[model samples]
Target: MSLSLNLPESLPVDVLAPDALEFDRGPTVSVPVRSLRLGRSPRTGGLNDEHCRMLAAAGEALPPVIVHSGTMQVIDGSHRVRAAVLQGRQEVAAVMFDGTADEAFVLAVRLNLVHGRGLLLSRADRTVAAARLVTSHPYWSNRMIASLTGLSAGTIGRVRGQLTAQTGPVGTRVGKDGRSRPVDGSSGRMKAYELLLGDPSASIREIAKRAGVSPSTAHDVRKRLQAGEEPVPRHRQVPPAQEPAAPERAVALPARSEPEREEPADPEAIIAALTKDPSIRYNNIGRRLIRWLDGCRRGVAECPGIVERVPSHNIDSVAALAREYAHAWGEFAAALEERNREAC
Candidate 1:
């Protein structure tokens, strides 16, 4: 035989709050305990036993859970039921609320999301958070968020990428009147975006002005473009003008000079000295003697002959010395001639 248990009627949770609303109560709802209804989804996730134990320990009445009427979906407070069930609760108290499926989905997600807070981020919440940040603080750019969060600038950039990406590449550069102007080759989308974000007074026109291009040009180039056509190369934007080369100058030749003959110094003096002492070294001569003979040889052929310059006294002195050493030599040429004549 099974023990009979009495279960109270299910409570309905309204979207609008009746008495008071607190964060602990989960999403606010309208209606009393008597009018509450069961949520179709019954709220999922938060299925841990620890929460159930805590709820059981509290020994307090259950707070109301918000829900949508049409879909009977749980909008918030899924964990409360899970906790109660885990604690062997016979009856789970809840307040019913009325809302559309979309509203209920958002509310339920926000409620369960804030509970754990450490789970992997949901796509909807991430998108909502990003949208909220961008809308509330217009000055905060993706790069700024990336910087603070230590995420790649590209990551944050891609988050809000399509906002500016949908427009044509040329749209961002076009002026109000729709004319193309020159843009700085160095400017990038991130840089331009930063410029506008930093100064609220800045418009597309201001950015175009700083970029040194017409508003239209900046507009067109700045907008996102498709993959088909190649970007108009900036290098070809302006044709570089060319100038004529300077005429060549005539270089004059240097005049020719008479080549002087390089002669040995003191030729005559060196010859005479060598004759007197054939065994002597030439480098030991005095500088004056070298210089004097070198100067004299400059026009030696033009000078008068020196064949008759020997004095009789010097010749006689030289003959007497020769006669004194005659006995030390072989027969003289004159003696040989006399002997040949006698033989003839």
Candidate 2:
């Protein structure tokens, strides 16, 4: 049975509710342990023995597992399910929601990607899994899979090419960004051309909206018109007047120094510190490290900040720690290398 539910492309967050870890989650229910399924795919991963053991110890007190409302397929609890079965559990707690197989695949990939325990797969393996999703969810588009799976669109495209059925009916409007956009690029560009021709003196930005193109595109057309060329269709190919060919002079400007780039946080220090805590086990600490690192990695992905951005005063401590990251990172790496050699 196919279930229909709108799955958001971006990570959905509820502003009004404080405890919504994810959006569109359903109510919790008790499911038979034997009925529950594993949450990993070849693209994601299966349960770890250590993780299963930990969950088994948690018993009835373990956190609820997430399952698909349609198929009752587990989306994020392979370890927990395995543990319950091992512990002779009759039933396991689960949270169910409606979603497609494709959606489930992506959700599994994403959950594993950002989870505290993680998928435990190598980068290439993870990419291969995410890329395969392109074939399963064609409407999912290359970029959408890339974003959710944390793989590159280029990688996803390569995977999509390997599929037997690569083409399908394209109805849902997708942006170059791989997500839904305000307008389709083709129609928007055409509209921009129409609006540009309609009013030669109208505001470029305003015309861009009517034309369904970006303001920058409209501005480009304006500049072309100002340069004695037709903005839309080719009217006159030649310039009206040739300027007196003036000799160009080279001007030398003083070289400017730029501020040192902020260093990215090394997860090693955080990992080490968290691991050394007597209260937390190594496995639990590792999971927490993964969670924190995932957040930090995603935060730094948009680096080379947007131009004309306002300063963020609230995260001064975070900013300071980041600045000192590289220095401590070297020490952590060296120590890890030494420890590995000693073990070998």
Name the regions of candidate 1 deviating beyond 4 angstroms: 1-46, 86-91, 115-344
TM-score of 1: 0.28
TM-score versus the correct structure, for each prediction: 0.28, 0.54
What lDDT score goes with residue 57 in model 2? 72
Global lDDT scores for all candidate models:
0.41, 0.54
Every model's Cα RMSD, please?
48.4, 10.9
lDDT of 2 by residue, 203-226 (tens): 977987777667886887666545
Q: In model 1, which range of ten residues has the least summed lDDT?
A: 243-252
Give Cα distance to truth, residue 40, candidate 1, Å: 10
lDDT (Cα, tens digit) per residue for candidate 1, span 204-294: 7887667565566445543422222212333322243421121133122233444432122334533443332212222355344446545
Candidate 2 whole-model C-alpha lDDT, 0 to 1: 0.54
RMSD (CA, angstroms), candidate 2: 10.9
Name the best candidate (by lDDT): 2
